[model samples]
Target: MSVPVNGGDLVVSRLSSAAPSAPTAIALHGITGNGWAWLPVAAGLFGRMSLWAPDLRGRAASRLVGPPYGLGTHADDVIALMDHLELERAVLIGHSMGAWVGSLVAARHPDRVSSLVLVDGGLGTAMPSWVDPDLFMYAVLGPAIQRLGMTFPSPADYLAYWAFHPGLGPTLAGPTGHLVRHYLTRDLVQERGGWRSSCVLDAVRADGSALLDDEEVLTSPQASIGHGIPVSLLWAPRGALNQPMGLYGGAWPPWRPLPEGITAERVPDANHYTVIFDPPAVRQVVSRLLAAAAR
Candidate 1:
C-alpha cells in the first residue's frame, strides 16, 4: 500500500504472519532497490515477524517522489513510515545504502529504533580518493546503476539485461534463480518506447554523495558505545562483482573501527546483492534479526 509522506506517497509492502505480538521489522532497500527487494527477507522471517518494506522516495513505485532527497530525508521518510504504521519502535534492517540510512534514523530518532541490523552496509563502502567518485560508484554498483538509463521491451528483456552481471548472472541458473528473477523484475514499468527501470538516477546520485559525505554518523559517540541501542553488522565476504576480495579488503574501516559493543559477522561466498537474496545469507539475516528482537 502507498502512504502519503513528506515528498509523496511511499509504497510499502506488508508481510505479516500469525505470530501474536510479532515484532515489526522495517526494511530499507539499497540505492537502486525498492520494497519488493525484501521479499526474501519476508519469506525467511515467515510467521516470525511482520515486515514493512518501503520503496524510499525515488525508486520503483515511489519514483515520482522528487528531491531534496538524501540520507537525512530517507531517515525522516522511515520515521514517517513508522508513524503511519503506529509503531513506537521497530527493528531497522538495512542493506547496502539502506544500512547507511538506518544508522542515521537510529541516531536521529533514537526512540523509534529498537536496534540495528546492517547487511553489507552502514559501516561505509570503500571510496578511494584517487578514483573518480562517479566512476567508482558505477564500477562498484554495475548493472544496478547502469540499467537506470536503459529501456527494455519486456520484463524478460530486463531480466536478460541483468544476465550479464558477473555476480548476479552465474547464480541465475542455480537454485536461487527465482529469487534473482524477482529482484530483476521488481521495479519495471511500461514506458512509451518499452519497459524502463523505475529507479531515479538523480536521487541515487544524491544518496551516493550523502553516503560519502557522512562520516560523523558512523563514528559519533552517540552511535558507538555511548548509545544504548545495540548495533550488529552482517556482511558479504566477497566484493560487489563476486570477486574474492571483500569490501574492506577483509579488514575493518580505517576512519573508525567498529565500536566495542557492536557485533559483526561475515557471510561467506556472498556478494553485495546475494547477501540479501541467497538462502544461506537470508537465513543468517533472519536469525540475527530474531536474536536482536529477543534482546
Candidate 2:
C-alpha cells in the first residue's frame, strides 16, 4: 500500500510471511524506478521477513516536489515515513542512487537505522566533467518518456514500446514485459486523446539535476565510512562505473576510502543495473545482509 509523507508521496508496498514474528526490511529503488523493482527480492525473502519498498520522491508513484533535490531531502522523506509507521529501525536496502540516500539517512539519523545494505552503489567516484547537464538530462529522462510516451491507440502499442529498453533484464523480456505493460496501462491517464505518464516531467527535470550533480553529494565527506555506521556495500563486478575504477586508479565520488568496519562484497558477472534484477545475485546479497545485521 502507498502512504503520504511530508513534502511528497511515498509509495510503500509490503510483503510478509504467514508468521507475524518476522523481521522487517525496507527496500529503496534507484532513479527512474519504483517499488516493483524490489518485488523479486521481496518475493525471495517472503515469510523470512516483512519487506517494505518505497519509490522515492519524484520517481514512480512517489510525489514530486520542489528542487534542490539532494540526498538529504530524500533521506528526510524516508525518515518521515518510518516515523509515521512507528518503525524504530529497519534494515535499509538501497540500489544505485537509493543507496546514496540510504547512506545519508544512516549518517544523519543513525538511531533510525538498524543496518544498511548498499546494492552496487555508494562507492566514492568523481563526476564526469565532460557530460553536459542538458545532455545528461535527456539520457536520464529517456526511459520515463519512453514508458509514458503516448496514449497508445491500444495497450499493445504501449507494450511494444517498453520492450525495447535494455535496462530490463534479459529474462524479463517474457513475463515481466506483460507485467510492465499492465502497470503503464493502469497508471496512465487519457488526456487530449493521448495517455500522459502519471509522473510530472518538470519534477523529473528538477530531480535529474540533483541526481547528476555528483560533485555535491558524491564528494561530501558525510557519506564517508568515517561516520561509524554499520554498513555493507555490494558492488557489481561488471558495472560500467566499476570498470572505470580500475582504469582511473580508484579516484571516485563519496571521495572516501572503504571504512574499517564495513563489509564490501563483489557480485560477479553483474553490472550496475542488472545487480538488482538478477535473482540469484540479489538473493545472495540480501541473505548476507540479513546475516550481518543479525551479528
Candidate 3:
C-alpha cells in the first residue's frame, strides 16, 4: 500500500499470518535496499509479528520521492507511516542505514516507537573530522555501494552479480534464493537504454552527509532515546562484503564509554547482508522482536 507523506507516497509491504492480533513491527532496510529485503524477517516472524516494510523514500517503488531527504526526514516518514496505518506504536527492526533512521525516530519521536532493533548499524562510526563525505560513504559502504551507477544487461546479469557477492553469494545460493532474487529484481530499473540500481545517489549523499555532519544523527542512542524503550544492537562480525572486520569489527561494543540501557549481542558467522536472511541470524532477530513485543 502507498501512503503519501511529505515528498511522495511511501510504498509499504504488509506481511503477516492469519492472526489479526499479531504484534506489529516496522522493518527498515539498508542504504540502497528496498522493502523486500525484510521478506526473510517476515518469514521468520510469520505467526508472531506482522511486518510493515517500506521502500524507504528514494529507492525502488518510492524513488520518485523528492527532496527534504535525510535521516531526519526519514524519521518523519516513519511516523507518517505509523499514523497512516493507525498504529499508536510499533517496534522498529532496522538494518544498516535503516538502523540509523530508526535510531533517530526512537530518539526524537520516542512515543511513536516502542522498541528499536538495530542490526549491524545505527551506531555512528567515529570517522576523523577532516574526512570528506563522499570518501567516507565510499570507504564505509565499500563494495556494497559500487553497483549504484553500473548498468546491467538483464535480470540474469544482475542475479549473477549478486551470486558472486562475497556476503550475498551464500544467501542467493542457499535456501532463501527465491526471496533474495525477488528482492534484487525489485531494485532494478530500465532507463538510459540499460538497467541500473534504483537507489538515488543524491538521497544517498544527503543521508551519508548527515551521518557525518548532522548532530541529530551523530548523537548516540543513549543520549536522547526515551526512557524504558528497549534498544537492541545486533552486530555481525564480518563486514557487509564478508571482509574480516565489519563496521564494529568482531566485537559487540567496539568502542570506549559504552552506552547504557541497551542490549548488545553478536550473530556469529553472518555478515551484514546475511544477518537478515540466514536462518540462524533470522532466529536471532525474531527472538529479539518477540522479546520487544512481550515488554
Candidate 4:
C-alpha cells in the first residue's frame, strides 16, 4: 500500500492480521534500509499486530522522492500515511534512522501515537571534537552508506555480496535468510553494467547530517512535553561492523540525562543488523514492540 505525499507516494509493505482489533504498527527502517527489512519482525508478530513498514521517502520504491529529506520531513510523511490509512493513532516502531524520525512523529503529534519502539537507534551519537564535522556522516555510516555506489553483476551476485556483510552476513545465511534475501533483492535495480542499490545516495547524506547536527530531536521531546507516549530503546552492544561498541560507543545514549517516559535496555549478542535480521533477536524485538503497544 502507498500514501500519496507531495514528493511522491510513500510505499508501504504490510502484513495483515485477521483479528479486527489487532493494533496497527507503522515501522520505519534504517537509513540505507527498506520496509522489507521488517519482514522478520512481521513474521514474528504472528498476526498479533497488523504491521506496515514504509520505504520512507527516498529509499527502495520511494527512491525518486525529491529533496527536503530529513527526520522532520520523514515524520510528516509518516503522519500523512496515518491520515491516509484513516488510523487515528498507532504504535510507532523504528530502527536506526527510522527511530530518529519516529521520535519526531511522537513528539510533534503525540495524540496520533500510542507508543513507540526504538530498535538499536534513536539516540544521539556522541561525536568527538577530533572527528571532522564534515566527515561525521562518513565516519558513522562507514560501508553501509558507501555500498550505494557499488554494483553487482547480477541479482545472484548482489545476494552474494550482502551474504558477506561483516555483521549481517551470518543472519542472511540463517533461518530468516529467505526473508532478508527478499529485502535485499528489492533493493537492487539493474544498471548498464550491473545492479545497484535503489537508495538515493544524496538522501542518505542529508539524513546523516540531520542526525549529526540535531540534538533536540532526540532530546527535545523529552526536554519539553516528556512525550507522554511510552517509549523503549532496545540497543545492541555490537556495532554495524560487528565491533564490540555500538553506535553510542562503549557507553549508551546517556551522554546526557534520559527523558522521563523513555527507558533503554541492551539486547545481548545482537549487532546493529542482527538485532532485526536474526531470528532470536527478531522475536525479542516483536515481543518488546507488543509490550510497548500494550503500555
The whole-model lDDT of each prediction reads 0.80, 0.61, 0.84, 0.81
Per-residue lDDT, model 2, residue 97, is 68
TM-score of model 3 relative to the true fold? 0.95
- For candidate 3, the per-residue lDDT at 156 reads 92
Worst lDDT 10-window in candidate 2: 246-255
Stretches of candidate 4 off by over 4 Å are 125-134, 220-225, 249-257
TM-score of each model, in listed order: 0.92, 0.77, 0.95, 0.92
Q: Candidate 3: lDDT over CA atoms?
A: 0.84
User: RMSD to native for every prediction?
Assistant: 2.4, 4.5, 1.6, 2.3
lDDT of 2 by residue, 1-295 (tens): 5566666556776744425555677777765566676666765677777777776676556645434355667778788778877888877888876777777778777777777888866555554767565466545435544454456655565555555545443534643344344444544555677655555555555545555555655533244345555688777654333243321123332234665667877666565655666666767776866674584
Off by over 4 Å in 1: 18-20, 125-132, 220-225, 251-256
Residue 210, candidate 1: alpha-carbon lDDT: 67
Sequence-dependent TM-score of model 2: 0.77
TM-score leader:
3
Off by over 4 Å in 3: 224-226, 252-257
